[model samples]
Target: MTDLRHRLDAFVKLGDFFKEYCKYAKNQTQIDDNQHAWLKKFDEILALAGHKNGWFTPENILFSLESWAELLTPSKLESWLMAYEVDKNKPKSVALIMAGNIPLVGFHDFLSTLITGNRAIVKLSSNDQVLLPFVAQYLIEMEPSFKDKISFADGKLEDFDAVIATGSDNTSRYFEHYFGKKPNIIRKNRNSAAVLSGNETKEELTALGEDIFRYYGLGCRSVSKLFVPKDFNFDALFKAVYPYNTIIEHHKYANNYDYNKAVYLMSLFKILENGFLMLKEDNNYASPIATVFYEFYDSMEDLKIRLSQEQDKIQCIVSKGFIADEIPFGQTQKPSLNDYADNIDTVDFLLKT
Candidate 1:
């Protein structure tokens, strides 16, 4: 195998470790001191992650780990990379400005940089500082060659040939000004939406709750908006999604729910609520926490055109047969390695850079 193949094998091993650690974590089992040092370190990192960010609940962290574990298998890695010509030329330094909205949100970019034979200079978000570095350490231990290729930046990012930065719409402007001259992928705020045809089964609608409530709807893949047919009965939707009402128990989420509900009521905006999530008639894509903006569509063709026109602001579209690229309900958060954020192919860009 070539050096790149060796690196891919090391990542597959790291994925196996993540799977084992997640199993133990979910069971709350104590790791033996004599167990692999990496396992103990993984335990420490999981604890630190929860302590650093309240939203990084143990369940959510494990969910993220499980998703990655499923995606990083050797066969999956090979399939994802099969289309690209991973050259072993002089590797460029790729700087990554990661997001912390979801656990390991920027991992795809990190993996792309290394798998494509480039150095990664990662600047982690304060909200997500613990997990990726530990994964990097595991990769290094599995294949020492990665030690020189992986780095974490504490200060201004310099000495990089290309950059991949993800942030809110405001920060994207700053990134454009700073890194505009360099070959870069600067991503702004984007949100996902779901389309309801009024014929969805209760089970399917309930599954859609996962797309909305996962990570408390902080991830770009989380469904923040809904497009339902005219005369759609929201009672069924609310009843189906009632299982996720437990999200209100989280203080942060409760606070947002109360605040946003109060604002909408004071503004005299007609809204529907099931005591947990509020749904309002709006056309916007990015909804506030605990609230999902929704719109009524009269024609599927027109809706498709509008969605296509506004594709830049959309991430994943949750539907059964509405569009060719529609993601199945409840599967938005479980994106494969090839599901590049914003539909911009990171591996292809890295290979060319």
Candidate 2:
């Protein structure tokens, strides 16, 4: 299991499993006898996942599967690791403290530690307890050697050489207090926002709705805020994103919408709404569910400077021609392998450890 090729092959096979399962689940393909049983297994798993967490909708879970399947190819994995010197590494136990804001939110860290020939001591969030354990089981089934390489922590985490922990700004302090002395990557709350010039096309605006509404705006990559020019009209934007009005049909989403709207109204906040989504003018980067906070900018130059100053508080700035690393309006959630969380190079850190 120390050899990189064996671990890499295991991940590729796992990716194939995900790709085939997705196709079969969608009625786009057929499964053979050996793999037929997995169909029901994954179906039940998705159902259980949704039951455990209301926000883990089947579509969002499937999207996560599809995205990982697309990225785990031989060429993509090789290309990503190609930039780093991965061979000369002493194996160490790495502790992974994951967040459950989105489904499979911590898979990258799990994947990184195991793929680099290190033992993983995982501590999964209660909100996402099932998915990754099943994933690890599948990988171990594909390559039995991985069984000894990964273990889940049910109580306090100990006997790990390093750690990668993700949480909110508050929980991050708790993490630092406990695991502060270890070689670690501790991530805090960071949000994404979009910059608009009021001239976006209909299709672009429609796509931006995906960025806003997907995962119920829970992921760090979800667009929770917007920077728009003064006097920006909302008529065109609302008309374009009207197709996603059905998002309000989900009971949990509808509850959030009703709750946040009532809170805003009672507080005498001036907000704009199109029945499903709300728009409020706020200076903050993080917005509550069902609402997107927007701020007016006087000039592009000044806005760029402001975003630069707050870059640490921002994750991905979804825009066109605004910043060097600006993610496209709708592609924030669909990040590639190189899009490290908090912009920290996990692979490089693990390789050295």
Candidate 3:
């Protein structure tokens, strides 16, 4: 058998091992009883993974896994391999620079390296250093061999065959200077948005709220902006999000909301027209503390034109107002296996090794 093929086989076995480990960790993390119980539901796992707020249920977990598998399947990996004419299961060290916006956001990078038969040096985020080791330990339990391939660096970053780094636009400059010399994927800040025809059902709008409010709107994938019809009813949108009003009650979120609101009011009072500024429009697409900031457009055509003009600035757009056969609203942050970060495939990057 080819060495690459053997490594690929080992990776498939590793996936089974890690999946079990993940399942076990879910059952045994050191959270409070309530949080643990809440995690017992698979949907709860999805909500946790995606930073949403629904109770856990089996289907949610099942669908989440199904979606993950479809994205990261062996065939998918091989397709990437075919393009490069390179061996996936070979000696290569991959340095993963993880993002901490969502729970264990850097996990996909770990899995990609493992399944592709590469050694990995993980640089965990300071904001979320606690959870990754617990996950890595479980993988070790599944297969003792994995212990050698994975290393969580608490100190300096070591050299690797390739690199994958994620951060804001500002930090990207540092990443580019440090790792740009090598083959790398350094992601910049990209804000997600949603298009509202104002015709969305209550359930869909509530789910959208989950997308916006989860993680307190810290993720790049979080919906930071919305495009709505000029005559869209703001009251209905606010009412739909009323259940999440408790988020506004939190001191941190309330402080941010109040601060931004005050600044906005002052700016309007000084020069801009109050009506045109759209106070209480909620916060912009970066982080929605409690409410949204909205700008009305006369029609979908106008909104589309504006969105097209600003496509460079906007990331993903969620919409239920007009069906475009493209699933827009729900696809934010919840990345498919094929949805490589920074719009570049990591396995493809590794092929150079």
Model 1, C-alpha of 60: deviation from truth (Å): 0.6
Candidate 1 lDDT by residue in tens digits, 1-353: 78988899998987887788886766666765654677767778878998899899888988998898998898999999889888644689999999998889899999999988899999999999999998998899889999999999999999999999999999999999999999999999999999989999999999999999999999999999999999898999999999998999999899999999999999999999999999999988999999999999999999999999999999989998999999998998999988999999998888787
- Model 2 per-residue lDDT tens digits across residues 85-120: 777778899999999999999999998998888899
Question: What is the per-residue lDDT of model 3 for residues 1-353, given as tens digits with 9 covering 90 to 100?
Answer: 76456545554544543354346445643444533433344333344533332212233333334344444457765775565555534668888888766566677778767756678899987655645565566456555666888898878787787888878889889999999887788888877777787788777777777667655666666676676776777667656666766665455566777676677667773221121112245434553344445666677786777767765556667786453522355456466566655456776666555
Misplaced by over 4 Å in model 2 are none
Total clashes for model 2: 0
TM match of model 3 to true structure? 0.71
Q: What is the C-alpha lDDT of each candidate?
A: 0.92, 0.92, 0.61
- After superposition, candidate 3 runs with Cα above 4 Å error: 1-89, 266-288, 299-312, 321-333
What C-alpha lDDT does candidate 3 achieve relative to the native structure?
A: 0.61
| Pairs of residues clashing in candidate 3 | 43-57, 44-56, 224-285, 281-292, 281-293, 282-291, 282-292, 282-293, 318-329
Question: Candidate 3, residue 261: CA error in Å?
Answer: 3.0
What are the C-alpha RMSDs, in order, of all predicted structures? 1.5, 1.1, 7.0
